[model samples]
Target: MADKRPQRGATLNRESNRFNLPERTADGDWLDDQAGIDGAPPRLRTSVTVERARTIISRNTSPDIGFDRSINPYRGCEHGCIYCFARPTHAFHDLSPGLDFESKLFAKPDAPALLRAELAKRGYSAQPIAFGTNTDPYQPIEAEWRITRGCIEVLSDTDHPLTITTKSDRVLHDIDLLAAMAAKGLAAVALSITSLDPRIAMTLEPRAPTPERRLAAVRKLVAAGIPTHVSIAPVIPAITDHEIEHLVERAAEAGARSVSFIPVRLPWEVAPLFRAWLDAHFPDRAGKVMAIIGAIRDGRDNDPGFFTRMRGSGPWADLLRTRFQIACRKHGLNRERIVLRSDLFRPPEGPQGELFG
Candidate 1:
């Protein structure tokens, strides 16, 4: 496979949908009738399908994460990170979690309205709603669809708390909304930065914003008074583990309040996809990389036990934690967790009632 195959990250389109859907195969008959024939398949294109979700907010009781409630404005992230643990979810839609997970996408245009309705429930309580918990809220299509901006507008109008995690610099587009919320202690943001190396970043997360741009976004978000932090998520063992200290230093330079890292987790379909990507891009040390990951994950590809899943176990995990802690101490990061205020929340006027002005 060509190293520079446009901007897509997945190496192959594995048809692993649960229903056992037939795999997609190239058809040269149509190509032959249309143009000068080359057997090479046409470049893949992204397609967005509108998902009119009955509800917008999803609640979870997992012990590993911070927030209990969250929202994913879109499904099937286009950033195309080869190791995204969310990849298995696309299998429910009868699509390949590999290439199809990136090329095909979904948008919830009704998110703002649904959010308003839910918030207006009579006994509803307030808590920080996390965006990009599953898929990115500010993927490229966001520039046109503006679903995330619309949801932020709703949150802003209602004085509700929200947190955003994204790898794209597009979050800066809604700086006005976020900054206003920050002024009231109702907002925070974290940009996921995995590797500082351009080459690794290229194949690892083909379409995400460059590390320089993300750090620049951190500077701008900080300047705007948003409690912006840096998340060095999914620290792929051999591929990106070497850049932990460098990333923390850069995050500090950008004025980030905290810097955190998560050792890579390959839960289901993501494991195969990530392995294929490793074999293709980093063949020299791919075995060593998996060995380290296995060591970190307690001799398994993944450990799904609540707390252990988030903070991997074993000697390698301890080393990563120690290095990250040292880096944070050296840079004075993670001094305090930015706490958003839920007391300020006011439910939006909905069909149920218009109590809030």
Candidate 2:
């Protein structure tokens, strides 16, 4: 029961990964044997590596997902959300999914050029491209890299349809571009707000924008004539589940045109990390929360199937669905899905520099 909470700027203790291909594990026992004391862990620092992506658009045909093409301007989000399913992706780089996933990040500096090139290809077809599917396109580093902004510029200029999802209010910084795209029926956005309680949000998503800030952003986007939605994502069973109705009501009042929720998913490395997070912050209800999640996930920490994974199975899942539906109905949210038009899409005129050449 000692204080397991991470230091001021850190979220995890940087544990070794169990899924690492080389199978590495840390042994503190050796240090104890030599110095009769445990060695202090290294201080975590955020590092950005530039990735020259050969292609910026990723295609997927998952039956559960709504989009076929998506773009992630960055990898390994710095938001440090304990329940982020994208955390496990760090394992592919031989890094710990715990602290390293957040501290070490990648940016696609050439995404805009690559995207333009791809769109200009012979058989390229217009479709709504999704952003922030794996990591927040507007994460903190975005302020310096501006990769997402560049991609947005290309999309807007070509009149290509695009959808964005993020928990950060930084999306508002692009209001001009987004508003223009929306006017052409080429843009929409969804903001994810998990809990209204700042204390819970601090512990769960240490670096993400506050829930209230996200709500305000929703209002701003809606007022600007952008089709905006609010996502009460990863509704923890015993913890944040109680706030579902209140969240929907507040979102509706804030001018969200639609609302949706997803049950907590603990896939791969996220399972252990989330369990540790629960023990640290919500020790009292951690067991109950995991039990309910197990019930929804069919006695497992995760369900990887196509359709069922998005919405878990079992009575708990059914109850969550019913509660969400009732709240949406009561608040008059989700009246219609925002559909962006792909017909307006036209390939960007070859590289901007070419005109001068």
Candidate 3:
């Protein structure tokens, strides 16, 4: 079979799992252009599968991460961001970490009920439960599934503290609930804005909301009295790194109370996919970008070490840190961290007769 190019912003034409399976190559006559072979254009459609999870809460012991417990209402994201570090997780389902990770998705409809059950458990303890940690809770699918919204309803009912991180303006749809939770110090949100340049953003994160829309969301959230933060995440070196200061300024101007950033992370299958993206959209500087990234990661494509992973090592990393600090200080970002109150947690009413009995 000839190599089939993916749709714009999509990656990987075929499923390839590097783990628990050996690599396979297809061999046959190749054509320079396979476009008109069948007189039909290749179409990539998003498909969602329902996942019935027994438990909704996931626990992580990694010291590098902030929250210990998180709830992912969905698996896989439709945003099609080439640099998403969570891409490799698709391989566990015998799917490609490339295209399949974005095109194929999973939604957990029972998340709300499961979360309530867990919270009702006798020994359950409440801490900030994070959403959109592994996959975006507000991905396009959420508009239809509403699983994330349902989970939030459960959290809100119990006054359980939680944090959300997303790149979609769909979050605004739940503003009422979020506002109520915020009033009780039970909720906070962070919008991740990678680039303000539309051209770069279009190719980098194809289906996500535009930069302007995200900034608007920050304004809206802040205006509603809900603590809002902006995340200049996955700051690609030689690509989006230059926009750091400007992004911070714009977000801060838009009413974000705090700001944070993370350098691009290429873990597992994400490295190859991101390389392909660079070749497709930024061929001229692709090599230089990777070289700088390697330097930052200590001569590797990625650094998985807990502390070193989030903020890389070496001079490039130091420079980014210095630049970020200067910009934050100049723009008055990160004045304080939003701390949700876990003391307000109260388990929701149990089964109808059980509570009365």
Candidate 4:
């Protein structure tokens, strides 16, 4: 396998002031083919910064999502999934939503302490808190920062119910903490596997672990007595949609207890990013691929309506849903339906009110 690094205009350090395109432009300047730059490509370098977050509890009232509160210990994932919906968030920090979104990462070092403080609040109500809802907490940077692990330690200590959604297998590194939480029905994990094809997975989520490795992680988590689920997320039409059944079946075989899926979403800048990715990797089928996506998204590159956003509305959407349901039934996954119990929540001691009382 080729290194797959030095992708287009991406640079690993500060000295490389000039950017190079996958292919040169007509003007002799480096043109970033991925960003659709036909002229001179901008010279940019990836820089990582850390910010102290005031609060870790993110509240969500959307009827579409399963959990009410979530925590993102990091901002901007290093996994560099082109179709990530959270890419737009980088713009708020004066960063480009393109390469900068992935390379330029930010982590909240104080997340664990803040989480503990929040849980100890007088009015804190216990709901199954979610992790990796915005940016993956287990993204490559977590190894050194340990912020996500620390937050999990807090949850495990307090017996707070929690959920995790991540594409990285690094979650297995904290199995002891997760297993302890799971023993008390306080933890569940959802591994997001976009596709089983290595080639497609590489282009789709360039920095994420291999699909097989993630499945192995699922098996490991299950063997450790942790409840596991698989999310066949961002089901790109005309591309990986064909592997839906196979992927789900494999997940079930790996001991996944539940499964869920979401259609390809091109919210904000993700439309152009995904299109560029398709052109770079699958030039011949980019147009057809996007057409199917638009069909599911109601004739537009994206549909952002609250209810329709997660799962699009149309015949294509219905077909995907039907396929997922059939696969789930075939594998006997999601049949047990073990819902997290909120009644066992106990607020931490000190400034935070008692959660179990």
Per candidate, the number of residue pairs that clash is 0, 0, 0, 6
Residues 83-136, candidate 1: write the lDDT tens digits.
Answer: 898888888897878777888899999999999889888999999999998988
Tens-digit lDDT string for candidate 3 (1-357): 122344435445334555665432321111323445674335556888989899999999999899999999988898988899898888888777766778778989999999989999998889999998988999999989999899999899889999999999999999999999999999999999999999899888888999999999999999998999999999999999999999989988999989988888899888887887787788899999999999999999999999999999999999999999999999888878888899988877777846695
RMSD of 4: 6.5
- lDDT of predicted model 1: 0.87
Q: Which pairs clash inside model 1?
A: none
* Segments in model 4 whose C-alpha atoms lie over 4 Å from true places: 1-46, 351-357
Runs of candidate 1 exceeding 4 Å displacement? 1-4, 17-19, 23-40, 351-357
lDDT for residue 343 in candidate 4, whole number 0-100: 74
| The 10-residue segment with the lowest total lDDT in model 2 | 1-10
Rank candidates by TM-score, best first: 1, 3, 2, 4
List TM-score per model, in order. Answer: 0.94, 0.91, 0.93, 0.86
Better of 3 and 4 by TM-score: 3
Query: Where does model 2 exceed 4 Å of error?
Result: 1-43, 351-357
Give all candidates' CA lDDT scores: 0.87, 0.85, 0.86, 0.81
